[model samples]
Target: MRVLLDHNIPHELRRLFPKDHDVYTAQFLGWEDYEDGELLNAAMDNNFAVLVTMDTSLPYQRNIDSFSLGVVVLDVHPATPDVLTSRMDRLVEACSRAASAREVVTLN
Candidate 1:
């Protein structure tokens, strides 16, 4: 799967995802300045299967359900590398399911 890690997520965390999955960060794609709606649209345009973000308010702010690509929102307190690393398994699972169905999933 082609996954996009939002600007809020640590760029170094990209290496933590499964090897079979291709992961890129917003900064890596020169998309760090985009707004939420534009970012999602760009992801879809670029054939990204899913977008992983730590912004819990994204769903409420944007009608993500209307997007063709999947959205996996991470709900974590103090979203540090260690905290996110521990939840990799669950995050990956959510990403897979969301990508498969083009659904939005929140992993806490």
Candidate 2:
């Protein structure tokens, strides 16, 4: 799956994804300044299968069903690398399921 990591997610987290999954950061895509909606749209336009983010309000702020891409919202506190790493299995599972779905999956 091609996953786009939202700006709020640490760039270092990309390295934790399964090797077969293509992961890119919003900053790497030149979308560091993009608003939530704009960033999601761009990810969809670029054929990103899923968007991993730490934005808790994104689901309420945007109509996720309107887009074709899947959204995985990481609801972790502090969001440190180790914390996120401990939840990689959940993240990967959500991303895998989301690759073919357009729903929002929240991982706490």
Q: Note the Cα lDDT for every prediction shown.
A: 0.93, 0.93
Candidate 1 lDDT by residue in tens digits, 15-107 = 999999999999999999999999999999999999999888898999887999999999898788899999999999999999999988999
RMSD for each of the candidates? 0.8, 0.8
**What TM-score does model 1 achieve against the real structure?**
0.96
Tell me how far the alpha carbon of residue 45 in candidate 1 is from the true structure, in angstroms, after superposition. Answer: 0.3
Residue 57, candidate 1: C-alpha displacement in angstroms: 1.3
Report the C-alpha displacement of residue 18, candidate 1, in angstroms: 1.0
Candidate 1 ranges beyond 4 A from true positions = none
Instruction: Score candidate 2 by TM-score against the native.
Output: 0.97
The sequence of per-residue lDDT tens digits that candidate 2 reaches over residues 1-108 is 899999999999899998999999999989999998999899999999999998999999999999999999999997888999999999999998877777899999
Error of 2 at 62 (Å): 0.6
Q: Output the lDDT of residue 81, model 1.
A: 86
